[model samples]
Target chain A: MKKVTAHDVARLAEVSQSAVSRAFTPGASVAPDTRERIEKAARKLGYRPNAIARSLITRRSRIIGLVMSYLENQFYPVVIERLCQALQRDGYHVLLFISQTEDADEVLTDILQYQVDGIVMASTTLSSALASDCQNAGIPVVLFNRVAQLGAMGAYSTSSVTSQNREGGRMVGELLLRTGHRRIAWLAGAEKTSTSRDREAGLCDALAAAGLALHARGVGNYDFAEARRAVHLLFRDPASRPDALFAANDHMAIAALETLRTELGLRVPHDVSVVGFDNVPQAAWPSFDLTTVQQNIDEMVDATRNLLFDQLGGQVMARSIDVPCVLMERGTVARRDDEPGRKPGRARQPA
Target chain B: MKKVTAHDVARLAEVSQSAVSRAFTPGASVAPDTRERIEKAARKLGYRPNAIARSLITRRSRIIGLVMSYLENQFYPVVIERLCQALQRDGYHVLLFISQTEDADEVLTDILQYQVDGIVMASTTLSSALASDCQNAGIPVVLFNRVAQLGAMGAYSTSSVTSQNREGGRMVGELLLRTGHRRIAWLAGAEKTSTSRDREAGLCDALAAAGLALHARGVGNYDFAEARRAVHLLFRDPASRPDALFAANDHMAIAALETLRTELGLRVPHDVSVVGFDNVPQAAWPSFDLTTVQQNIDEMVDATRNLLFDQLGGQVMARSIDVPCVLMERGTVARRDDEPGRKPGRARQPA
Candidate 1:
């Protein structure tokens, strides 16, 4: 098959090659009638302006490198979809990289080869060295849903957007306490993640304020299998089993709910109550109906885009924005006024 | 900040500019010690070879355009992660486009401008005209998890890798029948999707072979809320309620299970049996122990990668490959020999 070129479209439309190029170029000055004729001819010939050539001349690729991990968690996929849609609306394409390993230096190096205009590290941490490398290369980096521990010295033009995980945890703690729960156990996600640590800290702080201590603790590593195992170990001793459980994230919380009900043959809210963080889509289902903290994904995505665009437009300031989370009261927790033998209240409709 | 160029690296490293270029170029002849020296100086000076300039010279971007939709469905995230890993292993990057609308023509046009080497349309249909345009442009396109109804004339240069939806549906039918289920209902995905239609057709074919017909039908639109509504409608009349339910995908199947057990107050496998396609990770959870048909995602991904690479290597033939699905027997279906009051068998260990 013969390759369609600008010259072919120009000849067919009876216009110069430059005119055909101008018609394809966005924001380029072109007479409306001539542009229409050129577009018609281009359509007939299936001609497309080579972006590689145009990028070389403009020195901009209009592409962003999105580095993410943990697609299995469900929440990450929602965030990724929203981020991609937001970026596309702004005329930027995403070059996606799924990091399978903890050290993203190698993946970051490979992404640099593509000359992406900026980097969005969604749910993944960026090392200070790499942050500095990006700073020196004039590439902006925005950390989404994760924060860098790089102190002021290493804060090299890296911005971050995160949910108020600690505050969300505190809300969950207060809800569980107000519902008349005493034996409250906590399930943690990956211990290394800032999200897990901050949430755990907030829950602890809230419990301490209420003159109550966490009855038990286990690590789920943000995985279903690990969470199931954690549930079994936490509930092994019948005499001391928890009256309520709070998980660091929804995936683990769902796993705990299933394990407690199916394997342990325990009734939710009557025998034990459960609360989780990150009110994912599954939390609203009839089976789980888990009360959780809702992370405002849209706001986080908007902040991330604004930060990247601001950096691209020559505003180089590193800042962190924390969006508040809302507590979604659902079916898992027992109502304070309910009799001991009565059924739990129906799940509240999402507001 | 000033941009660092090859000349700067050469001057800093005390090497020829050609030697510096060769050091950065893969497979180019450069002494190992001299290469190390050049790399060190380049790192210090922040000098990296620009991909846009190199692509202009070589006429290859080593990038693949991955067009996808429906990330909300859990199955798709697994597939995306696997496909991205496979492509990255072969030294290619993914430029991801999430199609928010039915017509992908605009997205495809934008992707083409980036000069991607090929495209993998995962679970998205390509218009024949766009397929022809890609062919004329010498860009290979592979339809992953979907089949093209493009008549022989429109086949142009498109290949596809898909699961045997019909055979899988037949397997579901046989399993339900063998388990003594008489009245089986099916909840389908979006009507226009090939995955939905093919699975439904195969299911009907199997039931017809058994001298029976599908007892009930509902459209879930491949969504949880829709599936929950479908479940309620199907069970509204207890006298004629379905004895078995089959959902075209796992997400809807899960919704049906939750609705039946929690809202409808029906026991699974005793009052009704359930089966779903796509053995997503959640199927193995103890609470949902769902019986499903497992699409061999790894093999499908491998086939998709090979197909795309072959097309990029100048192979012009368009072929359709149907990978088989396996029936994963779990806790959702009753054993044929069990007494009417006995509990369903425990879920089988994943092989």
Candidate 2:
């Protein structure tokens, strides 16, 4: 088959090659009648102006570099899919670069060579140095669901969407106080991440307010296997075991339940109350039925898409979006009739 | 920050701009000593040869357009991620186009202006007309995880490593005969897809060899919700339900288990033996403990990456591949005490 060229379309349309090119180019002026003719002829011949050639002169490839990690979890996939859709809607393409390594600087160097106009770091695994380096390269980057220690770029997080972690912690602590459960434990995610740190701070603040304290704490690395191990170690000696347990993420919470069910032979909410953050899909799977603090994923994605577009349109004001979170009570938490709040197990009853 | 140019690197290295470009270009002519000096200078300044400008003269862009769908499936993410890593390793960047609608021709037309060297259809959604149009524009495309009815271009499938439907059906029939199962039923994936068709054919052949037949068959649309609904219909009358249930994928199997457990109060492998395909991550989770057929994903990925690279190296061998599958036994299936042919899965368990 012969290659179809812009010249062929131009000849067929009875116009210069430049007119054929202009018909494809945005904001490039040409007579409407001639432009229509050129388009029709190009369609007939299947001729398209080479964007790579044009990119040489314009220096804009219209590719956005997306750096992400933690795909084994459900959260990142939702964000990546929505971001791809929103970017594609605006006549741009996404160049995905997934990494599991700690050093973001090495990743940054590779992205810079691609000459992407901007970047969106949707993974908490991203290094602060890489974020700063991208800004240093004059590329606008917006961090999603994370915070930066060094003030180099824009960031958007949903700290407000859920009950203030500290306040929620206090409520739980006070409830424990009322229930006469003296000892309690906290099973948290890794300490390296800001999300883990913030939640821990909130839990401690609430405990202090109630004149109580977390009897034990363990790290789960935000995975089921790790959380299971953490729980096993925390409850190895019956004397030190807490009457209640709280995990920073749902995977850990689910693991804690498995440990409680298999190892200690404890009935959930009857012998020991439990709570978890980031109520994921499996939380409602009947088997787990965990009570958790729900982070509205759909709303978070909507906000992120808007933030990316705002940056593109030069909305450079220092803005932070606070998303609200809700406490979802299920079979995992103990019932208290006297407590002035929504009851547990409300969502779990079979309709 | 001022952009680092090849000229800057050349001046620092005490060489011409052409010499600096040669240092970066493989097999390009430059004195050995001069090339070393230029490379060192480029690394220090972080200068890259202007690939954007280079594309204008070469009439080839180191970009490939990828039209993809099935983002919600775990299978697609793993495939897309691998494809991205493979392309990046080859020094080529992907211009990703998300094709969700039937009007995939618009996506092709939109990408034509980008002058991509080739294309890959990782989507099950794009129509034949759209695919042919892309070919007409002089871009060679290879369908990944999809087959072309017209055979206009290259394609690779699991035909090489796995048994065809006829062979697979015979195996199942033989197993059922040996195990003394009287009645069997199958729930399949989307009827339009070749994967489903092939598997279904194999199972039927096995049934014929045993002088038995499929008691029932239904379509589940390769979804968990739909599979549950289909299972509900299949087992509405408990007395007449088939003793053995074979779900084509693990997602469907999990859904079936949930439906049977909660809705019908049926016990796994006791009242009804359930089998599934694709040993996904969740298959190992304690709640399901699914006994499933496994396709070696890593080996498939390795083969795919090599095939794509060979194509990039201009060795377009329009070949097909088929990876073999293994039947894994766990809590989902009844113990086959009589069978001596089954491979020991106790050794294959992931550590």
Candidate 3:
């Protein structure tokens, strides 16, 4: 079968080939009636304007390179789905690159080969060298849920979107302190990550303001197994067992809850109050009923999308967006008299 | 700065442009010392071969359209990550399309415009018309973890890779029956899915061979909320409350377990035994300890990769490959004397 081209559609629709092309090109100027006629003819003839040919002419693939890691984390999959949907609405498709921290440079090289219009780096850090490469290539990159830690050089040249991690941590700290928790411990995610560091800093600040210090701490590497080990070690010394524990993320928090209850035989909010960040779907399970800081994913996604577009439109000077987090009070945290009347736990809602 | 080209690299390395291209291309012949020179020069110049231009020359985008839904299902995220990694190793990039069931056609149309070398439809159904369109377009498509249920015409023209869902379900039925659970209920995933249908059929076949029938059944639509509701309705009447519940997938099974234990105040395996398919990470969590069928994801992924390549290499005549499932004996199911001495549950292991 001979491939149907824009010429065939134009002839059938009684329009110019350029008219058919404009009709197919998103955001292109075309009369409404002409677009309708061209679309009808193209559909009838099974004509799909070759995106590759158009991309060569315009130097715009309308494809975004999404470099992501930690798919095991429930939160990331949600972020990925939302980003794809949001980007698709703007006529952009995602060229997904699953890369590890050490391999970011290699993956970035591969993405550069494809000449994706923009890049979204989620939950992973990029080296300053690669960031400079992206800048040189004129590919707008927005870090999602992670902040670049490149030393002052060209740092502000890359945009980022993240939840206010330190504030969320402070909220958890204050809640724990108000609930009469004298000894509080923290289970940090990967120590190198800015998200983990900022949240810990906020927790420390809150603790300092209350004239107390963190009783203990452990690094979970933002994983379940590591968190489980942290829980075991944290509770081994019953004399210094933390009255309240906060995990850097929900995955670790859920794992901690299970270990505390099943293995350690501790009652949540009674023997040990627990809180987590990123109110992932599993956090709301009735069995867990975890109190967590919600990261406002939709807002963060929107900010990232807008940042990429702005950068693509030649807006220089890197921007960092901080979306607010909400503390979801659930069964995991104990209630205090000084505290305001807590809303009913949102456990019953599906994630 | 001017963009570096193959000609520049050749000039710097003192080699032919074809030799420079061969050095960059995977599985291409290149003299060892000359290839090293070309790579060093390319690195020095910060040059990347333009894949878009090469794609035009080769008429192969080297991009596979991965149309998927349900990233929320933990299984899919793992699948997506593994597939991306596997495809990357084979010199292909993923153009991810997140689509809803109703919009498969629109997504397919967009995919066709990009002219991806092949398509991998994961856990989502496509209309026969779209399958025919793909075949007509000469784009080889492999349905991953799903079977095309296109009516008689052109049904056998598409390839599929799936776990033996019916066999997996039959294993569950036999295990439950052996453990003396007479009053069993089945919680199904989305009704239109071939996986759910095949599993249900196998369960029925096993029950029929035992001179029994399904005691009760409910549709969970392969979602948490829907499964929670199914659990409530199935247990509403204490007299007919099912002693054994088999969920089509791990997500629904986990939801059912939470509802049964927390809301219904039921003891798993004592009051009710639970069995689920797709032994997902959560199934092994200390709290759930769900006995389920384990789909060999690695095997399935490998088969899918091979199938797509074979199809692309002009191997016509559609084929369907079924990888086997293993029944993981965990804590959720009651033990039977006829069964071998099972090892202690591997719950402490990380998901």
Tell me which residue pairs clash in candidate 3: none
The C-alpha stretches of model 3 lying farther than 4 A from their native spots are A1-3, A7-41, A152-157, A335-351, B1-3, B7-23, B26-41, B152-156, B335-351
Candidates 1 and 3 compared: the better one by lDDT is 3
For candidate 3, lDDT tens digit of each residue in A1-351? 356889999999999999998887679999999899999999899998888888888888999999988788899999999999999999999999999762377788899999799999998767888888888777888889888886566454568999999999999999887877667899999998889999999998888887778888988889999999999999999877787899999999999999999999998887888999999988888888999999999999999999999988884767899999999999998754343432223111222
Output the TM-score of candidate 1.
0.92
lDDT of 3 at B35: 90
List the lowest-lDDT window of 10 residues for candidate 2 chain A: A154-163
* TM-scores for all predictions: 0.92, 0.84, 0.91
Better of 2 and 3 by lDDT: 3
In order, candidate lDDTs are 0.86, 0.67, 0.87
Candidate 2 lDDT, B1-351, residue by residue in tens: 457899999899999988887887889888889988988998787675666667667766777777776465555566666667777777776777777752356677777777777677664534566655654554566666545544345332211122233444445555554555556788888777666667777777776655567777777877878988999898877666766787777767877888888888998877777777767766777778887777666666566556555555553544466666676777876645543443323212232
Error of 2 at A145 (Å): 2.3
lDDT of 3 by residue, B1-351 (tens): 256789999999999999999998889999899999999999999999988889878888999999998787889998999999999999999999998772377788899889899999998767887888887777888888888886667454578999999999999999887776667799999988888999999887787777778889999999999999999999999877777899999999999999988889998877888888888888888888999999998998899899888878774767899999999999998754343432223111222
Question: What is candidate 1's TM-score for chain B alone?
Answer: 0.90
Check candidate 1 and list the clashing pairs.
none
Judging by lDDT against the true structure, name the best candidate: 3
Writing each residue's lDDT as its tens digit, candidate 1 over B214-304 gives 8889999898999999899999998777788999999999999998999899999778889999999989888789999999999999998
